[model samples]
Target: MHSEHPPLFLKIAAWGGVIFLHFPLVIIALYAFNTEDAAFSFPPKGFTLHWFSVAAGRSDILDAVMLSVKVAALATALALVLGTLAAAALWRREFFGKNAISLLLLLPIALPGIITGIALLTAFKTLNFEPGFLTIVVGHATFCVVVVFNNVIARFRRTAYSLVEASMDLGADGWQTFRHVILPNLSTALLAGGMLAYALSFDEIIVTTFTAGHERTLPLWLLNQLGRPRDVPVTNVVALLVMLVTMIPILGAWWLTRDGEMVAGGGK
Candidate 1:
């Protein structure tokens, strides 16, 4: 028997859809190197690395980048911890309202960013907790946790609980069983989840806006730069840089999670 290929028209449509979605990102990257920086010009006059130097020299941009890095790092860490514990508790368990509990765990990411932001802002105001870096991390973590949770729970379902039992039967303590058996099984999933959580937190704007207050993350800085028309090229350079940074982790996560068994688990 011969394997069938997708129809030519279907292939063209798929490529067209991908190009349509990503072509504008290509445009932004191209304009980042444009010599004519007065405003956007098609077939950019020439290309140069001047804007990259300009972006590098700006302290505000550096600060914003650093702040975004910090927030994303912190949020990813919190998400990994919370998500792993939640997955461990909820996996292979029968309990009351389990589905509802799982739904609540997922609610933050499921809701619109605007809604999440508003709720966070309102809660902060009601509690007299000022919006700032910590607030931003909290807001980002709420959604980031969902990503980590989903990844971990999928892994948990694929894992063989019997291995854990066997480890215990062979004289392994709870910590020893987890350290030797469970941790190895979860390492890749945890890494993938952390990378995804980092990527989401890095580029988040809406929740960041409400919780950031006077704190300027890279996305907020980019938003501010948009108002300065002459600096648009520099902004493009920064945007390109952000894209590159986020792309690595997103691609890494995808690669790590690509194997069915990787997301699923090793045991049957």
Candidate 2:
């Protein structure tokens, strides 16, 4: 009794949902090129690249962008190491408190961002650590690890353990086996996970709000720009840049992992 295609209403609803979600992004993009900069007007008066040039000349914006990129890079690096190791440990192991550990690993990302931010802030204060660049990197890493862990663990599930055994049986040492066998198999998954983690860290705002004392990431800069009505066009340009930076990595991750079932050493 199943139909070959979804009902017409379902299709309409799905498309409508897509548009509803993306329309704001479309408007932001359109406004980024608008010539009239006093305030957003109905039906853009003109389209020009003036705002893009203006944004490029702002030192504050440049500094915010550099800080964001640095934070995201460092956070993604930490996540890659910790997440891969955690996934490797939990993938085929049975141990006491294993489930608890897994849950804790994912807890940061599942909790509301504000809660995580507050918790991280309190922890830093308890440790007498000042909220700054390092704090922001650590806070971002907390959730970024979850992204990498999920991707790497999913890849591990599809990967064949027999390959590891075979490498060992062939007289390869632990490091050699990992380098030749495991790393190759995990390369795409790690890259995809790192990309996703980078994207997530790049646009994060809530956690950054609590941890970034006297330091402004791009998102924080954009949030502050909201108070300056004259900077609407510049804000739109910067917002569009944020979208592109985050979107490219996400799309790259999707492309890398789309055929996830066809993993190396999988079908044996």
Best by TM-score: 2
Candidate 2: which stretches are off by over 4 Å?
36-39, 261-268
TM-score of each: 0.94, 0.95
Q: What does each candidate score in C-alpha RMSD?
A: 2.8, 3.1
Q: Summing lDDT over every window of 10 consecutive residues in candidate 1, give the lowest-scoring window.
A: 259-268
The superposed Cα distance between candidate 1 and the true structure at residue 213, in angstroms, equals: 0.7
lDDT of each: 0.92, 0.93
Candidate 1 local Cα displacement, residue 72, angstroms: 0.2
Q: Please list the residue runs of candidate 1 whose C-alpha ends up more than 4 Å from where it truly belongs after superposition.
A: 1-3, 36-39, 261-268
lDDT of 1 by residue, 103-149 (tens): 99999998999999999999999999999999999999999999899
Which ten-residue region of model 2 has the weakest summed lDDT? 259-268
- How many pairs of residues collide in each model? 0, 0
